[model samples]
Target: MTATRQLEGKIAWITGGGSGIGAATARALAEAGAHAVVSGRRAAELDRVAADIRAQGGQADTLPLDVADAGAVADAGAQIAATHGAVDILVASAGINVPNRAFAELDTASWDRIVAVNLSGVMYAVSAVLPGMRTAGDGLVVIVSSWVGRHAVKLGGPAYNATKHGLVALGHSLNMEECANGIRACVVMPGEVATDILAKRAAPPPPEELARLLDPSDVARMIRAVCEMPARACVNEILISPAWNRNFIAPGEAAPRPARAAT
Candidate 1:
């Protein structure tokens, strides 16, 4: 198959498709001939992504969704299946992190919100698509985790760290239970990407630092490559990071400073 059409005739549903890695992956998959269905809380952003794909002469659709909402995610999944057939690929990339990531500053509310969007939300999206994949006897799931997911890091905060780590196990469990059904799951753990999520950090990286970080397209390309692999082969995990991994910096030097106490 030609590289440009490797995913021809496939259907891919990408959560968090409005921006960052999700948006980049949508474009990549579409260029490869998959009908891309982009979803996220921002309807306008999703529309923009879809429009850009169509402008490039590719099939694209948009579904405004809040992955944290179980009913909404399920409905969106059902709607897509009815309108476009079974989803051949699912990219669960919706995630969030708060500025108050330090355990000393992290609150229950923040913890719950992060878990809802990052961990439980992923579970919902995965569950929504599994039935169709099982019936088709072929499917690929790419869970966009983080390098912190595999290695604990103070910079990622407790909630974000916990949820990301959960994704690794979740992806593995899916492969163990569903491999016989011809379903493959891969957890992509990436170190520091220069995405909007960075703005939520206690201290956003400087331009010089951002330049050294991975770009959304970099991770997207990896995801697309995984999607192109034959059904007989399965990539269980991918750990990708920029050459200048900040995680390697001295612990105290890299950790975000805790917010100061209120007067």
Candidate 2:
């Protein structure tokens, strides 16, 4: 009567999973049969997600962590392994466009803030999980990236652009370097998802414009695809955007639209 979980018996760890794409992917992975560990700085939020998964009869655990801290990431990795086994899937979705201002307007402090979390934090996450994967003889690393990584677009600041671009290169390098070891690395670049990213960037959604953007569920489905895949076939990069789009728009002009009353 119950649907079979796609990743049954596999363990997964999702970073920046308090909300948005990471949170959505966490739920999707659990539905796919993975025992998912959702980690983030907010314990309460992660706990809520974990509880929901449990209520759905899926296995889940929460780890309150800051991926920017390598030590904490490593420790969390160990804890998850001890609790559910070595992770078969790792989703590096924890990031933000800190001080989302123009490149010239970005001071060194703001630049470092974005780089530390989006770039360095991903490194820490991958490194922390590698040992377990190596011991197990296989692993999958999924990095949630952005179209900005492919080619520059609006809101493309120095820090955000740099990290997104670097992630593609990182994913490729990992795939090639670890292919023989049965480790698959992939980057999911999704655009204009319905998530807190705009707010995180202090760019509010346009009530009218919100309808055109991609939803987090779309991105989550991509992550699920990567996670459910066999190591034999690797999806290197997924460049997704709003089915409809404009080259550019004012920051505030991207908000959601109000529903129309029926005539």
- 89-170, model 2: which lDDT tens digit per residue? 9999998875446866778888877888898899999998898898888999999888888877757677788899999899
User: Given candidate 2, what's the lDDT at residue 107?
Assistant: 83
TM-score, every prediction: 0.94, 0.91
Query: In terms of TM-score, which candidate is strongest?
Result: 1
In lDDT terms, which candidate is top? 1
lDDT, candidate 1, 125-194, per-residue tens: 9999999999999999999999999999888988999999999999999999999999999999999999
Q: Which residue runs of candidate 2 sit more than 4 Å off their true CA positions? A: 248-263
The whole-model C-alpha lDDT of candidate 2 against the native structure comes to: 0.84
The CA lDDT at 85 in model 2 is 79
Q: All predictions: root-mean-square deviation over Cα? A: 7.5, 4.3
